[model samples]
Target: MPLEFVHSPTQQTFDIGSRLTRLLTLLFSLVIVFNTIFAFSVLVNLKSLDTCMFLSSDCSWSAHIDYIKDKAWSRVNILRSLKFTLDRLTLETINMTFIRPLLEYGDIIFDNCTAGEKQELDKIQHEAARIVTGATKLVSIDKLYSDLNWQPLSDRRTNHKLIFMFKIKSNISPTYLVNLIPLRPADPRYNLRNSSDIPLIHCRSTLYYNSLVPSAIRAWNTLDSSFKSADSIQSFKRLISNTPKVPHYFNTGPRRLQVHHTRLRLDCSLLNYDLYRKNIISLQACLCGDSESVRHFMLFCPLYTSYREDMFESINLLVPGTAITLDLLLKGNVRFTDPFNSQLFSIVYSYIDSTKRFI
Candidate 1:
C-alpha cells in the first residue's frame, strides 16, 4: 500500500487565482447595480421634478380619498402634506409645486381665499406670513428656497383646499405674475390684494363699496355712540352725505374742444376765400388778440399791429391800415405784401411746427 504526499506550489497558486477572480466579479457586479440605481434617481429627479402632477396617482403622497371621505379636519392634515410636497419641489420642481398651484388656485393664493378649505386657507396665510417676514432676507433664489424648505408642512385640509385655490389662481392677470416675487407686498397691484373690482369670497360686502352700511352712517353711529346730540349727528351726516359732486375739467378737454372747432371752421372756409383758406390766416384768427373770433384775428385785431408792421417793413410793403376788412384782404390777392408774409402766416407756421415736433 502507498500514500501520495507531494503538493505543487503551482496548484496552490491556481486555486487562489480562481477565488480572487470570483470575488472581483462579484464586486464589479455590485458596483454596476449601484451605479444604475444612482443614474436612474438622478434622471428621475431632473426630468420629472419641474413637471406638475400628470395624474392623480402622481400625487399619491397620502390616502387623500380616505381623508376626504371622513370629513375630519384633524385627520386631513392638508397643510402638512402641502408643506412636505413643497419641500420636494426644486428649481426642477418649481412648476409642479409652485407654478402649477399658482396656475390652478392663484386667485385663492393671491386673494378671495374664503372658498378655500380650512387647511389650505391656513397654509395660504402661513405662506403669506412667512413670505412677508422673510422678505428682507430673501434677496436671492437659493435663500428663498431654503426659507420655504424650513416652513412647517400644511395640514390635510390645507392640501385638499389647495386644489380649488390652484384652480382659481390660474385665472389671474399677467400683471399679477409680479406677485411671485415680494417686490411690493402692500401695494395691492396685480390682484394680489383684495379689491372691489370683482365679487369674490373675501370682498362680498352688501354695503356700498362692500361696506355693512354707508360711510356716513358709520360715522354718525360712531358719534352718536359717544353721546353726541341726536339732531347734530343727523344734520352732520346729512351734510356730509349730500355734499355736491363737482365736475373736474381737465385742461386738455377745453383745449381740444377749441382746437377742433377752429380746425373745422378753417377747413370748411378754405375754398371760399384763398387768403383765409390758408392755415396761417386761419390759425391767427383763432389765436391772436382780445377779440378771439376768427374775423378779429385776421384783419382789425389790435394785438397784431406791431407784429404786422414789423412784417410789412421787412418786406418793403406799404403798411396796410389796421382797419383793413377780412373780405377786402381776401379779394385783394395782394401777393406777399411783405416779403416775410403776415403775422398770421408766421403764427400758423409756428403752430404746425410745434404740432409736428410732438408727433
Candidate 2:
C-alpha cells in the first residue's frame, strides 16, 4: 500500500469530502425512519391515554370533559325532541335514571373543568328542566327548579365530590385519592359545626385546591353533624337522599299519575285553556265559558263539585286552615309538612284524574 510515489493534495481532499457526504446521508435517513415510527406509535396508542394507561399519576382530564360534553349533548338533543310527549315525571325519571348517571360517572373530571365549562354543562340540565316542566322561556329558573324538586348541577357536583371524599375517608373506596386527603384530630373544645371533619392542607396552586381532596374536605367540613355521623356508605347515601332541600318522591305514587299532578301544579297542562290563548291548543274549557285556567278548573268549576269535597278534605287533613288561592294552586306557595306534602300530592293526583272524565 506504501508503493505510491506521490499524490495531489486537491484530489485527496475531494475523496475525503465524498466519503463524509455519504456518511451524513445515511445518518439523516435513519433519523427520518425513527421519527416516522414514533409518530405512528403515538397515533396507535392515543386511546390508551384516556384511561391513563401510560401516565397514571398525572391523568389529563380535558379528554374526559370532552367525552362527557359530547355524550351529554347528544342525549339532551334526543330529550329536547321528545318534549311534547313525555310528562314532567317521566322526563325527570329519564334524567335521574339515564342522563344523570352518564354525567355522574367519572365525575372527577368535572373538578378540572373551568367555571365557564361547568356553566355550559349546567345549561343542558337547565334546558331539561324547562322541557320537563313545560316552562316557557320567560319562566324563572329558580321557580322551575323548586317545582321539579331538582338540585342545580353545580350543587350535584359538589355533593358527589363530598360523598366521594367521605367514601375515601371511611376506607370504603380503595383508590389513590386517600394519599391526597389527610385526617386530623378534631378540637373537642371548639365545638365545630361539622363533627366528622378533616383538616385541609394549604395548597400553593389553585388546581390543587380545586381538586378532589381539598374541595371535598372543604365541603365535608361544612356538613351538619347528623350527616357526618352516618355509620355506613348506604346510611350516608340515605341521609343525603332524605335531605329536606331536595326531596325525592319516587316512592310516593305511580310516575304516570305523578306527572298529571306535576302538570297541575305548574298550571301548564294540556287541559288548561290558558294554553289555547297562547295558540298552543285549539279548545278552551267548555264549562266556564271563560279561559279554562287552572284556578277555574281546580277551584271554581262546578263540574268538579263531587270531587272537590274529597280534595278539600284531604288538603285540610294535611295542613289545617291551608288556603287555596291562585298563587297557592299555581306556584305551590304553601309549604306543607313531609307526609302532608305526599298526601297533598295524592289528593291533587286524584283531582287531576277526576277531571279526565269531562274530557
Candidate 3:
C-alpha cells in the first residue's frame, strides 16, 4: 500500500486519536523514512484500516461500520473452521488472538457508535462464544457468553476505555487526548458530593453522546474512590478484574468435562428429553419413568440419587446458606466467592461425571 495523505479530522473530534490512525503527509519521503525506521508501520489506507475508517463528511463512522462488521465476521468465520477440532479453552484463546483484537481495534471510538453498530460487533463476539463452547445456534447469545465466562464486546470496550481514560488522566496518553479530560474543579464554598470526580461534557447532539470524551468521563466518574486513588495504571487494571462483564463461574476440575456441565446448564445435553426433542429416542421418559429433564436429571433422578446425595452434602457442608436448587448445582451462585464456587462446581460435576450422564 502506498501513502495516502489525510487531513486531521475536525468534527466528531472527541476520539481515540492516533491509537491507530495518524495524519501522515502524502510526501513519499516521510513514508519511506517511517517505513524504514519504525519496526511496525500500518499503511495509511482508510479502507484498509479502521483507525481512519471514521473519516466521512459528517464525521460519522456509521458509514464504515459495515466494513468493520464484514471484516470481523470474516475472522469469525475463520475461527468457525476450527469449531470441531479445538477444545473450548484453546478455541477461546485463538478467538482472543484473532477476533478480539479486530473487534476492539479502535473500541474507544467504536464505544460511542450507534446501538446498531455495537450490536453488529456483539454478534461477532456471540458467534465466537458459540464456536468456542460448541453450543448450537439455538443457544442464547448471552447464555453462551455466560457459560464461557467471557465479557461482551461492549463491556470489554468500556473496560479498555476506562483504562485509556486512566492513562489520559495520568498524562501518559497523547497531549490532545489528555487535554480533553477535564478534572472537577475544587471549590470550598459548597463542595458538592461528587466534586472529587471529573465533570461530564454536556452535549445536545445524540451523536455527541457517544463521543469518547463524555462517554469516558461518565464511566470514569462512576468509579469508586479507591479506584481513583490508585497510583499506577497496573493496579487499576488489576482492580477491573473485580468487575466481570458477565458473572464468572469458578469452573474447576478437568477442562474436558466442563462442556458437559455447560450442556447441562444450557439444557442441550444428551439427556432423554434433549434426545427425544431431536427425535433420537421414542420417549423422553427416564428409566425410572418420569419426564427426563434437567430438574429431573440433576435433582430427582432416582438412578443418580446415591451420587446426588453426596454432592448435596458437600455443598451444604461447604456453603450452608446456599439453598439447594438446580441453578445452584448447575450454575453455582454469585454469593459464593471464586474459591468456594470452584469447590461447588467440582462437586456438582463430580456427581454428574460419576453418573456418566453425558459420557
Candidate scoring better on TM-score of 1 and 3: 3
Q: By descending lDDT, how would the candidates be arranged?
A: 3, 2, 1
Q: Please provide TM-scores, in order, for all candidate models, with all chains considered together.
A: 0.20, 0.56, 0.64
Q: Please identify model 1 stretches exceeding 4 Å from their true place.
A: 1-7, 34-149, 153-359
Q: Best by lDDT, which number?
A: 3
Q: Quick one: best TM-score, which candidate?
A: 3
lDDT of 2 by residue, 1-359 (tens): 67876768988899899999999999999999987895465335322213221122454555656666676676666666656555556566766654666666656545665777677767778877877765655445776777767878777777787688778878878767687677667556676554446777798988777877678878888877778778898888777756454444423555556555556555556565756766776878646576677777778788778888888887777778888665554344335555665666677778777767424
Off by over 4 Å in 3: 1-52, 186-188, 243-258, 270-288, 298-359
Candidate 3 to truth, TM = 0.64
TM-score of 2: 0.56
lDDT of 3 by residue, 34-140 (tens): 76654232112112334335567877677667777777687677677756655566677767765677778877875667788788878888888877776665566
RMSD of each: 33.1, 24.8, 19.7
Give a tens-digit lDDT track for model 1, residues 1-359.
Answer: 69997769998898899999999999999999997896565444434323222224433212332332232222123322333223222222432343223323322222221224434534443443223222221133233334333222232222323222222234323544323322224445576333312222233443222221122222223332222222343443343233332111111122322222223233322211323434345533333334244455444446565654454443234334443444333222244343323333343333323333112
Ranking by TM-score: 3, 2, 1
Q: Please report, in order, the local distance difference test score of every candidate based on alpha carbons.
A: 0.34, 0.66, 0.74
Q: Give candidate 2's whole-model lDDT.
A: 0.66
Q: Which pairs, if any, clash in model 3?
A: none
